[model samples]
Target: MERFQRLDAVAVPIARPNVDTDQITPARFLHKPRSDDHGNYLFHDVRRRPDGTPDPGFVMNRPEYAGAQVIVAERNFACGSSRENAVWALYDHGFRAAIAPSFGDIFAANGLKNGLLPVRLPEDVVAGLIAALEAEPGARVQVDLEAQTVTLPDGSVHPFEIDPFSRHCLLNGVDELDYTGTLAPQIDAFMNRYGRENR
Candidate 1:
């Protein structure tokens, strides 16, 4: 997982609500392998047409929003059945964070565990941010994970909260195993003591 401290990119807006995991990556593609190439399949259904040509109408296909690293969205982003692949698709697509008013609890957890940051702000605040991104999709926005702040193109800032454990893990580039590895010594010592007592 990438250790994310700061990111600057053109933020893209998905102004609709209740964007589910299937929409992020269609169910038909679930059999595919996980790799950097997964990005090509992100939002497959919406990003492509029936003939498999890129849908030029989708925000992702628009020239200005190409390679966007952040998604500014409406409420209930990532709402649907729990699927870690959804997070994988987004990460592989190069989006490191999503700013929305709310998220599906399971999707948020899956995303955070995979080093994707999900930011929650008031509905009104998110709406304003979406408007800005829509008005100028190529304008850069700064996401400072260490500061827990998002700096808009015009220089305004909005703070967001993250779980302390998640923040710690992201800052250090440690996933669940890496975190458990930090306690290896303690676990070994406790096991040694148990062996001594049992003997």
Candidate 2:
């Protein structure tokens, strides 16, 4: 997992609500192995036209939002299904953070484990962000995990909260297994003490 300390990068606005896991990455593409670059399949169906050509009108297809690392979106982003692939698709597609009013519980969890930062803010705040991104295409936003704050394009800062453990893990670029590995010495000592007492 990648460490997320501070990010200052281009942002893309996705104004719709209730964007589901299937919409992020269609179920048909699930058969592909994890080694494959899922980036190509991110928003696979919606970003294309009925004839399977790239839809120029889609925000992602537009040149201005190209290489956007942050997504400012409406409420309930990634709301359907418990598929972890949704997070994978977003991460592989180069998105490091998603800002919204709310997120699906499972998707948020998956995002943290996979190194995608999911930010929850007031609806009005998110709307403001979306408006700014739209008004000025290719605008950049800042996310500082250490401060738990997001800086908008116009220089306003909004704070957010995350589970302490998740924040710690993300800051250090460690997964659950990697964190547990750090406690090996303590675990060994406890096991030795228990064996002596039992015997």
RMSD of each: 3.7, 3.7
Name the candidate that leads on TM-score: 2
Q: Write the per-residue lDDT of candidate 1 for residues 1-199, one digit (tens) a residue.
A: 7798899988899989999998987887787887547787789889999999998989888899988999888999999978788888999989999989999999999988888999998999889888888897788889888999999888999999999889988988888887688899999999999999998
Name the best candidate (by lDDT): 2
* lDDT per residue (tens digit) for residues 75-141 in model 2: 9999989988888899999999999999999999999999999999999999999999999999999
Q: lDDT scores for all predictions? A: 0.89, 0.94
In candidate 1, stretches whose alpha carbon ends up further than 4 angstroms from where it belongs are 181-199
- Model 2 Cα shift for residue 112 (angstroms): 0.2
